[model samples]
Target: MRNAMWMQGVEWLAAAASDPQACKREWERGAGTVLLEAGRHWDVVSVPRQLGLLALDILWYDPLRTPGPTLVDSAAHRVGFFVPPDPAGNWAGADIRRASKGSWVAVPPPYRSAGSVEWIVPPDGSGTLHPPLTLELALRQANKTLAVLAPVSAD
Candidate 1:
């Protein structure tokens, strides 16, 4: 049941990647060194570029089926890959403690950044790129989309 929901998330992520305009703004805001977009089930940590590898598992997704799938509501659980401000760290803020907490499911910190990455086409959520898309660029896109979901985001 959870995997089914995750598959839906992958579809939504791919649709978002398909939109240059939406993804562009999202890219710039995330300060992502790279942005990779694929189907919704993708996790940034899985990327070769992601610091420790910020893998996000889509616990749930609600789609509307237009311009491709989009996430109406979703849940994700995150695993720590890197520590922030460490350059090698993919984390957003502060440090990981013995007892970390969040409003959503467990994962890495969502950040507000000011750089951008672009994708030529959408991948199906393999966390790897295809055709015009590249792995380096995909990481940047992931950060942007993840940023959009930040608790204080305008997106």
Candidate 2:
């Protein structure tokens, strides 16, 4: 049941990546950073060229989803969610942790951490634009979309 719901999140994330105008801004310091907003979530996809790495930060708001206690902060409880990575590579290769926390009763934090979603893609805009029906495929395609959206440089 949880996995099915997660697929919904993937679909939503992909739709956000498909929009050309969804890009809101570029970071002054980050070379390949781009901000994307769609629906109720804000995603920051970053490509650090120097490090040859790509990362995505998605802030989702859904009062209907409740994360497990060990997945988030102790104070966080209720409808909010903070998904930890899956060590078994079930979700994407990364897993959620003890420090991760969320609360439906309160607002989520304003910061992103290593625990956030991570993936890789080519710099060219050669990714599948349509939303993937599965989580793993969605992660791959979303990373590809990020690669296309990420700035080549500070220019």
Q: Highest TM-score, which number?
A: 2
Question: Residue by residue across 1-155, what tens digits does model 2's lDDT show?
Answer: 54554444334333333352332222122233233332233212112221111222221122442212111222221111222221123332223111111211111112221123222211111212212122234345545766688789975
Local distance difference test values of all predictions, in order? 0.29, 0.26
Writing each residue's lDDT as its tens digit, candidate 1 over 46-78 gives 232221132222211214211211111111222
Task: List TM-score per model, in order.
Answer: 0.18, 0.21
Using lDDT, give the best candidate's number: 1
**Which ten contiguous residues of candidate 1 have the minimum total lDDT?**
65-74
Question: What TM-score does structure 2 among the candidates reach?
Answer: 0.21
Model 1 C-alpha RMSD vs. true structure (Å) is 18.0
Error of 1 at 7 (Å): 28
